[model samples]
Target: MAKAPGFVSLKEILTTFKISRRTAFNWLKTINQQLQAQKLDQVVNIPRYGYKLTDRTKKSLTQKIAKVSSPQMGHETILNAHERQTEIILLLLDQEHYLSINQLAKMFHCSRNTIIKDFKALKRHFPALKIGSSRLGHRIISDENSIRLTVYELLLRQDKLVYAFINRLNYSFSQAKELVIKAQQQLHMSFSENSLQQLTYLLLFTKWRITHNQTIDRSENWQWIAQNTKDVLPTCTKLLGKLGGNKELKGEIVFLSKIFLCSQATEVDCINKNLYHDINNIAQEIIFRYEQLTEQQISYRVFTKTLCNHLYATFFRVKFGIPFSSSEVDEIKWQYPVLIKFTAIACAPLEHYLQKKLPSEEVALICLYFGSVNNREYREFTESDKLKRALLAEVLVVCSSGIGTSAMLYHELSKTYPLIKFSLPLEIRDLAKIFQHNYQAKLIISTTILPKGKYPIPAVKVKAVLTKHDQTIIDSFLRQEVPRKLEHNASAVNSLVSIINEYADVKDEKGLRLSLDKFIFPGLQKNNKADLPTLSNLLPAKHIKVLRKKDQLKWQTVLKWGCNLLEQDEIIDQFYFEKIVQLINRYGPYMLIANNIFLAHAAPSNSNKKVGLSLILLDQPLEICSRGESAWVTCMFVLSPGKEKEHEKALEQLVDIVRNQENINRLLKAKSPQEVRQFLLSFY
Candidate 1:
């Protein structure tokens, strides 16, 4: 029949007061009516259990009980744990002297054990506040800033409680608001209404604390605040001085400056020249790095200005260890791994300047800035448009030697049939490899022999240079192979072109197409049906070569020997070997694809005659550096693809092998070239 801590069952109340069930029910109805009249929540009843009062309802009822209580009543009111805790905190803040646990127990009409438990619970919420018993008695110990933050948290939790406390201290809220307005006007900055309210409450609380002979310990970085926020510091100092002079004015100044810096307010010329320059430089660098990775341009002016404004607020949060909440960080990271990675790398300088490593959430916020800008360039395509592009036949143009001739043919063909997406020009020998990797290519137009039976896609032989007759043959072939339904709408394409021209400074149609293609489909465009080529097909036994190291050899010599093996096999011309050497010298051995394994090859050029692979296992390991990454080379593969770009598939397979430590270990441990080839072919 006893009442529970925060609730009392109707049965219990009836039994304890010796009342009838009907009377108890009627009393509950009256209480509900009164609560409703006061605009507070009524008690909720569980079907099988009892009536329960919410925390708000309990607090309201407790306040009403306290208001009507008198000493002549001869009975004390009971306070719940939350009410007791709030009372304890207010009491500690108001009094200069400490109150012992026994004294607090008598004051709350609770046992010392309950008071100790309340203090324990309160400590968890305010980590910065030290609550313990000393020779003097129990007291709350914390730095001024910690106390201020705790007060802010308390104010946020129960506004009525805070207002009551402030009212007791005779702090004028209206006067505080006036001081905040004066500060804003003097600093030439405007704060949001919410910010203004928060500042007013903070100033009022600070004045009350200082006047009660309780001064906060100075822990703020005044020097840093003065240097970085010189423009706003004077106004903040004046406002704090007006509230309460020099007792804790320095800490007050630091706190107010933080508010100004972090407020979601817009101000013209709020950022100083040096800080503006630094933020701008960092923003530009980030955008440039993003462009390099994506191969798409973004509007730098607007993005930089917006980023600078964000950083101004973020700088304060980072410097002062303020918590930043970003709920979408995980989702953004999952959706845009490449963007996040590049952004993190590009923001290294900002991180260093801030002297704090950015949390993933903060980095994800930065990604959003770039994403918003890029979204305007490449709006989400319609599902039908996506399907049309997906079904379009990818055509590869094979032209004779001469970059100029190949480029000219590519442009002409692309212009003639805008609907058909074409690959950059490839040589006839490279066609098979290019087709294997680019399974999306359903047709090939070659200027030389078709290399019959080498490709799965159909091939059309044309003159080294285009002619009117060749154009007719291409048009006839396209009619039969490419479905007419897959063609893009001319109007839609032109509209997209116009949109791009309006937003971007593209000089011509070719530039526009290239940019649009890159923006739409980043990385290499691939078909879902494109399967990775098997290792056996890419590295035949005849192509595998092993070398026995006689004494020691330089890393360059090791690379040269592998290239020579491919050249001697007639897989590539001498020019290919020279090109490979030139590549290594200029770019280093970045071609060392895996641990102790190097796959060296050059772009498909005139030097490459046919697709070829040569593997050389060094008896002695040679250390080589490639693209700033170093690897010990014990096994090397020299790939030469005829003008057909055969190396793409082989390179992809090699990367997979390198990624698998087990496969790389097995290959390195193989005794002979035949064993290495067998191990690689196991993947098939």
Candidate 2:
């Protein structure tokens, strides 16, 4: 109280004077009364905080605050920019109220302009270091957790004054080191040299925060804070209690337990029984999303199980904060930038579920898990799988019957020909629109005879009324119209070879010819580079639109706009758009795959001639309400997986492009469609 009259915690006051709370409060009351009688500013009590002294009050009480604040290096050592910025951060953490520019300049032996520059430069690294004029002068309001993490980081780099910071406040610096080392040895065979020191400092720093009335919000992550720390909670409880902590409060202990979760050795196989199940569920989803994005299935045994345990361990480490150093991270980032980006997208739901952002090292670590297993090691499709692909065969169910009958017929035929895509029954007059748009449809089963010159697509006349003869006719028509070959001419393959030769020197013309024939020829190799559609192939400049808030578009409106782009290219029929709407209405906004990015699609429709992908970037978000969930959508991607799931490659590329908020911002800020297209081209 005599040397430094900044805000000090009640615990520190009581501990220093060896007094109870009541005694401390009574002393504060008396001190305030005496100061008020003298017409001087008294110590102010801030709820959730202990006490702070105003400069006028300190000046009035000439006996108090005898010494001015000094730097860690005293008057001898002048700090460089980086060192001074870090020192400034440390100094702010000491003051309860604002420290003026003049005071700071005096303490650091610098000019006001130098301090201002330091403020600006420090903010570049520590964005949370808020600098603003308040009651009297410019003071920083830095987050406690962030500042402590900064301290931990400083300690990591062997900052000498880090310990002085803890000691200056007369805070407890317990030997939690011996305890942590003992517990870690019980679980791990060998540990890193500084692991004990890091864990010890983390626990003590947390205890220091608790003592100073700066505690973690217990109610924030109550679910994880409650159940996920059972194994380590008791140990942490004993350790904290031994170091003069409030034994009744378990919040600090719970936080320490989470730290313990992230500290296991690489060779350890310990599965945190409580956290593993949740982590496993997240792992399953990431794998599924990864498969969908890449359009290739990953086996569950090695990849799935490994990712689950790895994520379980890494989750807490990332959440709590760990700086990882890996040379491979840089190389992997440079070499497979797209893969890392896609992996992050796939891991997005996990991050959302946990409500925490993962660091790049964690993301890169997951990429290594994907890289180990993702060399086109796709699951071999069985005969049944091939049949399922053929099942995209569409049939136009034409009926002159009313709406009620059409509804009944649609479901009945759907169940009857489970493999076929039976379009909802349309009136005979509706046949023209269907024929014009859905020319890829193989057959039209009509309740009444169509006009002779009405359409080029073949039709079968079936009775509107139920009959055994009608079923036979429908059965005979679909069996013959089972999905036909891809139908590529010799010239198509020759042109492809010539294009490849033109751009790249063909070292193996004969080998390249064989590969091209297989890629082009039906059923030979659907996954070939030539066959798998990508964003570059599907979404041209014409297909992308920059929408705005002024348009006042709804979810369905932008959905239609995306569909219209594909429809213009004849990649999909109008019915495909209708199908997406119907399915979304029936199910939910499953189309909103990630935050603000809507991947609008439905099951493949064989009637669509080619795979289509289109984008609509809204300057403002559109709220999508459905039968289930509701979400705001920023970007809507319309994908028509025509006849096959070939659009997956395109979807994968789109995920890579927009998964990051930064990239989305960059794309949205583009002035023209050509700029947007060129931006996309850069990724490929």
Candidate 3:
């Protein structure tokens, strides 16, 4: 049979191991560090500068390959270690005649002392083997075919023990503990204080082995002669006795544990054995069945099937339970189809549980608490109801036009505001369909009225150009300070519309707010739904009613809350940064990006005249994204450098006006950014 395929690419490695690039890099670094620390034969003659395993090292690694329980593994082994070790040894022996110890030592890159010890051990195990002295100064030993096979079996057993040892250390603490518990239970043994303490020491010792390459001395093995040893020491001594003393220590448990602890390695040997064995066997079967196929076709068919089988077993175990086995393994082996089918089956549970775990549904339920101030009962935004509230920052936009200009505009907006998703293809004829096609869109913005004239969507209209009047309208969209009661007066709506229409040319914050205030009536009439009117509204045109929405106390609270969530003395992790981006996405229609600052404003459905603070992230630019079910999150805002007064003032105005503690608390609680925007729009 053709030799098994080598690791093809980094992408293949990542997929096989189910590790991120960051994680894979770390593992590679760890391996390099281990190689350097061991002072093993200097790494040489490799394609890249990565550490190279010497022949002995290759043997060691091949032994580890068999254990599929390590965190580094994402597949199952189809062959046992014995079959693999036998094949490798047979290939090696067949390539050379009467190999000498010195030659083997040179290949393995070990000292004569190690080779002598290994030869001595082999001789003791196979007493019938003949030894010969050569004039060429080579130490020779004889092994007939049966003896070679017998030694291969022993090597396979040793490899299995070593693989198990490494796997126990690398997977999880719980897994290691479980193995210990199961062993103890099966043996029906109870540990004394000393034995228990020894186990703890063993755990630490194992950890040290992986981190620092070191070897354990024979004295470090479990002690039987020491009086301090307790809990059936005699039984342990007797068992060790049967396994043989230092001269014949084949697959000793205490020694195996020490090696794994010191090496910080895993059972790759077992995996290599199984993987190769399956490749060989599967290839033979395919070649036998398909008599006319080319070599490439046969190889591809076998390779693909092997990959599929591995995925099926791995994902099956992950989805159901660890330490799992089914009698149906034979059936699966015969009928397994493609890798995609395995992935779908494996991901089912993770996806199912994730949907249930999201806080979006609860946040949606909270939106119900906000009944229309005018008793109009405007429908709240709906979609992604099952996701958690924290994920709401991603928005899908919906518009009347088909996927032409509006969709193009949505893509442009996405570049400026990466947190939000848009549904503006204009392909969606109605708001409900927009919600259905992209439930993840938190709020909707449209250039035209809803075709049905009644929209469940929290819809807002944006002028083509952003003028001063348009700023007022956009400003109203940012503040939930407007009331639905304004719908009763056409003059109020007309005046608000005119002011918004007039300011379509102004983009400045001052110009934006000034033109926007023309639409608000501070003391004209007070309804229970209206927030405390701004001081400017109460004082009328003669006197400005200047109100500070965010005071010193609120700022302090925000800083403290931010610190707590970030959980670091310095900057928080990037996940929180991504969340802030999602927040912006849910709230605003038009946003201005100046370095780190993000500003957005959208109007309410009941009264298009009122606007609310759509969203803002001022502390820092978002630099992280989190994956969520039923959503693709690109919500991150990065602050750049510029110290201009206008920039600072604009940023402060946006933060102070748009992100007060009350508003933030509500926004943060919103199931999606759309909901947050709608809640803000409701204020208008």
Candidate 4:
């Protein structure tokens, strides 16, 4: 058959030149320009075909190609040293057998001296390989493992060379790829892009080694493998069977099982008995500590199960020295210091089991788990709900059933009537007493009917299951009563301003009254409170403890002791200690506001109903992770506050103390809680 006219598709040009569509079009335009300059026919595009060059245009292009190939223009075509070395490495790696100097010179179209120099360069780059002249040829000799690793590195450095490496294996990757896809489907999990690439390379490497009659020495911890990898053994067996199973396949299976175990699997069931027990115990302790610190109950079963699976994979990676990376460690530390700190403490047992300290990246991973758990629990209360809650007026809820119906009503009312703050459920009989006690209570919602004229507060009766009508009634009541409550607050503030003006000379009485009005009626305030509450007011003598005798204490012990003081004083719930430690673990010792002062805290929760401060002055300085600062921490200030608004004043006051080095010095010198309180009072 006669050859078809020389033609090239736009897609083919793009793939060949590695250029974009526009560039390809521009090249064709340039070619047409050159042909026009020569006063010959231009390249023509045929519909449903590609660009076709006329016989005359082809002859002109051939002459142009010859001109560009001249010695003066040939510098542009020459490969750089790095590029040449990469090509040589690929050539060596892809070859079925070693190549002689004369053969490489022929392939590279270079001199014998040039080929020898390239070989010398390759030998330097890959010291593990023995590159020297042999009886047969100049060859690269290395163990299968070393050669595979070098090839993998080359592929990583040049991703475009992946297909080249695969082709050189003389083994199709389709079967291995199918095996992975099937395993992922069967296991109910998916591998990450990086993981899939690693697996593909591994399969190809394994096949090459097996075909070459090369075997890897057993280096995995067999005991650990026997106990924990039983679940993945079947999958590994199937994979090896397809790869043409051999006598040394068990070592490869063990290796493959480890890789599968370290994957981000949804669940991990088979674990070493001792490791499982240790992980469970550690998880329980961590949850317990977290609960005590936050004073919030976490779903134990769900948290433990998720944590156990994650730790199992972590344990495997740590044991086998498998590298792991996380870009979110710093972000997690900054955002969830308390949770990460708690996670770190929880991870202590695992560290002991691994016989090494856990890296910050691993600790950050654990923090992510806790952060997820916390997010799931509080997913309902969004940012808008928080804003609306601040504007809501307090209302008493009366239910004869106590918590059950009242709690439901509270959540429902919170969503429906965003302007109402429903109090905890109270008995119908306690309505009169509640009315007398709660001056802010604007209206009362009741599940049961109440007697008329029984209390001064307005009452609305509704069914346990609120209907649209009930919502309308409650919404209507809030619309009328909320504004009236604001007016009442303004009037009270006006009265207080009048009293204050009588006692002092006031030039700006109007301005003073406006300020007082804004302060009294929080809704009227333009700016949130900027000043921190006085440290003396927040930290009482009862919550402070002074350690007079010198005693060595672990950083964990210091956190627990401070937390114990806060818990004893009813400043925080039990888990607050773990939260404090978690914060330290996540963010390091950045909380050390001064030379000796350590300010420990967590996010506000119900456990901290009121702002509480505990001061623990150690007799001797203790070591802590300071992110490269001095680790001698002598004074620990544990602050547990119920809400951000409630503690804003206290934190401001604390910051002032922290900023002043003189105050910190005085605080360190204080021998007793009374002394510390006295010194803090001096600032107020």
Candidate 5:
């Protein structure tokens, strides 16, 4: 029997392509499909991995080549040497070039004698050139472009590995086919289109990296240093023990190690240095903000909240050590809305620009707006005609639930009935003398049911019946619209101290026994204040320390006021300056100076000063201010030299005080600067 037409073995193909068994199998399958699609009936099989070219594949491939040469096909090929050599010689002459017989022999892989015979046949066809040999080299002296196209056409008939290269690089196969068509069109080259397809596919895979981002004819380096660096850094950090040993670490290390395979060591190091610098900058800023808020008794519990997206963005390059991608940037861009919203209610104020720039949807902005308005509920009061008449004689209402609740009531009444500022509680017995002592205050309210003649400050009972004829009751203090301030009514300072003392005197081992009893113990009270830091039940120790430091500073400042011999104005001025400095240091010099000195502010564009700043100021040196409206602010907070965060907070507070009409009025009324500073300071 005649041997079947032979073909290359799968093993040989795999070795030639340097591909794994599986990959080789896949390639063979693809080749077979291409063959069968064209209806060539030829079979080949490796009998392994269910992957082989079947009978139909080889016939299809061979027929595909034959179709190009078939007379019925649109294009024709000159297969005989004599006929092809005439065309080759004429094609070269058309471009003003001549190919020596020797050159033709080397190009076609034939003997010089065979090439000479081909040239003689070509001369008979074109009658143009002499067959000759030269020592320098059998050079091509004809049209380079035409000759090149001729050679290209001849090779195109053989196979299509070139076209396959283009497809593998992710270009559309149609696009790859178009490129081959253009090469053939421009050069009068013709080929079995199947051959070009095969060539482009191989080229696509091998050259994928280099050609990925390029769409034009330009070439680019497939290997990028930054890309390599990103792949390697995580492993380096993990190996150095900087990153933890969990799954996350393992994955990052693997990723980075792969990058090293693609990149040089120098590139990796450069990327690492940049990441370290950025991370350190962020960490240091966070630490400084933590310290500032701690000093202010603000909560820091929100600092640990980060979305999955933010974590990825921040650590991707710094920890994972990867080149940045647009996808990552986009994720972070959308994440800002959520991040800013959550941060609004956090204990520490966010960076000032965020507070100013973010809309009400942002948590910090919402929190600040809400914080500006008092929300405490208050009791409604009504007066009888008799009480109104007595009020003309100056009566006071007092509640002995301690000054806390009553003080709130006093403020409510005082705003509408400004005449009765001295409404002391019924506890003070010297009513007439107390009423006479204050020019601004006249009436008082008493919490306990007491007779009018018995108490100090011209007391009125809490339950005093109301009368319709008393217009002042309806028109003045009883008006419901005025809001009350926050009041702390739990345990009085004296009561708490006395209870603690009694417990200590009794040597109570059960802990705070008398204090708990007298105070009507709240839910889950700890025995020792010292235990506060250890209690995970409470907020972190960081929070408690912050609260303590703030309280300590306030009390210390008050104590200093009582002991100091300086003029009141001098004392207040010193305190105010201290506060100002603190704000500037905390927020940054530009923000502090702008907020405090320049008084720059802006409200919502849609509303008439509904919220936001009402004033703006420009920078000015102290020399100009020394002469002043000749008036220097008495209550200010100043940071120590070189302390930015403290200065920022101080500046913020100073601006807040000056902008607030009520606070400013209170400060101006002070008998001394110290009292002014103390009063202003207490408001925050």
Candidate 6:
């Protein structure tokens, strides 16, 4: 009948069509689109009802369906190449026996060559399919579980086929579905609509396999997955009972359960023992590495919950060698080059712990997991964090290079805004190590480019030394975006209250809590490093020696002269000098890090006693020969790192001073060792 216009709920539509919720919605959308194309009135979905078809639309569609049925359904239905390829794969998955190319060609009403082309396309797209043929027929050559995973992938990519796929079940579809629904709801286990449909169909296929005597061997293979599903076992058992499955069929059920486990979650809280104990730690380590690598902060919630959810499935997929539902690693690698590299580095923890490289597809999926986090807005604090910063705002100050740049920023910022709290100078590498708990800092003021990623707090970019314009920008940020210095005013209020109490007594017993809250907040918010080796500490007048324009020295003598100063100063052992000499001898001009200057050094060792730098400047450059090549050295400096990254700031400063022509000229033209040291000390 062409039914009369009326409101109908989505539930009634699902019941009427015997399709999953996702399929029913998709069908409705397709129907509406077709109606719109024909310039006819379409069905309208009502909120409480499913859809309303007025008399005219109902009558129009009835005529349209009749006209389409005669040609499309009554005769051979032609399919596009992509559509036919999908149906062929579906047939291979459904068949218990191998299907011949001739049989598939006849069923789809296509030639053998066309069918073969489709097969070639399938192999080209999915190498994991392992398409094969024998004299008997062609078939999927992999295990049954793998075939099922491919079906899910197909359904995900081509969702319009979902309705037909779920509709063609051979077993007790309605009753088993009822039981599955009851158990899922009763056990508080829920899944995304798409995943629920896929897993339900997977359960049907598993049951079908068992009925055909293709049951999985060694059920203990699934016992490890049992730990996360103990509470859901009773529900699974009831469904297994409905399928006439005994204890032996338990492995298939557990495997089916994993489909829902790995899929996107909706309302169900995904935290579990493995999550709380194992995965969260992995997520934290991943976050640490991302921070260290990106020099930025991310949403902790995104990392701990969203990313934790992803890692849970990823670990199992890689361990079991299942690469279904992965983005193409190559495609993602090209699209997200920087992100992929950072993800690869961030996942080093997992790779080390797993004692193997992550599969390329898994790496891409994990890249996607990190890719989701790149755009998520940083954490926004409530009044509680603002209250913590109300007293003295914690600001992170960082600079581009040298130990003094950040220090210079801190002194200027603190002097200008004395009421605000500030951290010691920070390097670009140190930004991640700060604000492990983000609420501790309210603002970031940097002399360098702070990472452009999701840094939780507001960051202000300025010069190493503050300008009036920079001060104005900081003033605007503190006023507009940050907490005010309101906590300091609380003490003034207490003093005024005390003076008022000295004059008179007041009574407002019922409003005392509110009264005190006006003066005080309920609670205060509760929230490393070796010193940088500076130039003044590392280089002294005694360590700095120079040569005049008339007194040019050989490059070999230049390296030896500077290195012996370090040895006599007790900065390095004799072998340290030999190591430098050996480096220059073995690798000619290897010590020349800059144009016309040489930085002589050996790897840090136990022999190096202190972190220091010794310099020798020459007015006239000397040329040296080794390995039949020649290079010039106007200045020679020897540095013993003593420890790695400990003297980076001093090294940066030294590079800065040598890079400038005027500074080098002043040192080269120096009258004494005292003058050369004084010129270098000015930079500190």
Best by TM-score: 2
Please provide TM-scores, in order, for all candidate models, with all chains considered together. 0.42, 0.45, 0.16, 0.43, 0.20, 0.43
Give the TM-score (vs. native) of candidate 6. 0.43
Candidate 5 per-residue C-alpha lDDT over 608-651 given as tens digits, one digit per residue, 9 for 90 to 100 = 11111111111222211221221122222222211212223333
Top-lDDT structure, candidate number: 2
Candidate 1 lDDT over residue span 458-558, tens digit each: 78876534566788888878888786723444445567898978888876897666556655434333323145344566576666666664577677776
lDDT (Cα atoms) of all candidates against the true structure: 0.63, 0.64, 0.33, 0.61, 0.33, 0.61
Instruction: Candidate 5: list runs displaced more than 4 Å.
Output: 1-229, 232-271, 293-684
What does candidate 3's lDDT look like per residue over 34-96, in tens digits?
556655443333354323445544544433322222211233332222232222233232343
What's model 5's lDDT at 422? Answer: 35
Per-residue lDDT of candidate 4, residues 92-149 (tens digit): 6556677777775555434566666667777786666666578667655676545655
Q: Kindly report which residue stretches of model 6 are placed more than 4 angstroms away from their true locations once superposed.
A: 1-82, 95-98, 106-111, 121-132, 140-142, 156-159, 170-190, 211-213, 218-220, 227-229, 232-235, 266-275, 326-334, 374-684
In terms of lDDT, the poorest run of 10 residues in model 5 is 609-618
* Evaluation by lDDT, superior candidate among 1 and 3: 1
lDDT of 6 by residue, 1-684 (tens): 135346767776555533345545555665677678878677766565557766777766644321211111224333456666777776776676888888875565445666777788888866667777998888878765656666666654434454465556556666666666776676565544444555566667667667767664434535565565444555666677777777556666665555555554423343356544676677777775565334356646634665665666566566555555522335555555555555665675576566666775566556655554432221233434434442244776665422222333554455455556766555455556455544467778875455676677778887554666777888878876544653354574566666767786757533543465443532231111236777877888888887775565666677778878989978888778778667667756644534576777776777688788888877777887776656777778888875544655576567667656777676677778888878888886
Clashing residue pairs, candidate 6?
8-49, 8-50, 9-49, 9-50
**After aligning candidate 3 to the native by TM-score, how far in Å is the CA of 48 from where it should be?**
46
Worst 10 residues of 1 by lDDT: 65-74
C-alpha positional error of residue 630 in candidate 5 after TM-score superposition, expressed in Å? 28
